[model samples]
Target: MSSQPSCSQTTPSSATQSIRPVSIKQLQTLGGASGDDDAL
Candidate 1:
């Protein structure tokens, strides 16, 4: 697999921009339902 950090794992600012347009719930799904601190 490629050794790349996911969008969610990127810097908060970058992640926010890259994930822009995606709803919080959608982000949460991509982030998973474990309630990870970075879900938001």
Candidate 2:
């Protein structure tokens, strides 16, 4: 009598961490391993 589906999931250390600071036009649109494409 147990089909299974009830874990509820919320455990990455209670999840909520984003100090948010990534701008140089968003790291040049993040396409080249993001170091502003190796300073072009």
Candidate 3:
């Protein structure tokens, strides 16, 4: 809700740009989270 508007202020595309890389990094950090997806 409030957080969405905060990150999206600069550009509509910035929302995806900000989230995708960080989301991948977070999953990688979480260990088998990403690995499990790859294995499947």
The RMSD of every model to the true structure, in order and in angstroms, is: 12.6, 7.7, 7.6
lDDT for each of the candidates? 0.67, 0.44, 0.81
Q: What is the TM-score of each candidate against the true structure?
A: 0.26, 0.17, 0.45
37: Cα error in model 3, Å: 17
Tens digit of lDDT per residue, candidate 1, span 6-26?
544666777688678677768
> What would the C-alpha RMSD of candidate 3 be, to one decimal place?
7.6
Candidate 2 structure quality by residue, lDDT tens digits, 1-40: 1323222233332342221234544555775565666886
Model 3 TM-score?
Answer: 0.45
Q: What would the per-residue lDDT of candidate 3 be over residues 1-40, giving only the tens digit for each residue?
A: 9887876786768777999999988877877766777889
Model 2 misplacement above 4 A: 1-32, 36-38
Candidate topping lDDT: 3
Ranking by TM-score: 3, 1, 2
Q: Which model, 2 or 3, shows the larger lDDT?
A: 3
Give the lDDT of residue 25 in candidate 1.
65
How far residue 8's Cα lies from its native spot in candidate 2, in Å, is 5.5
TM-score of 2: 0.17
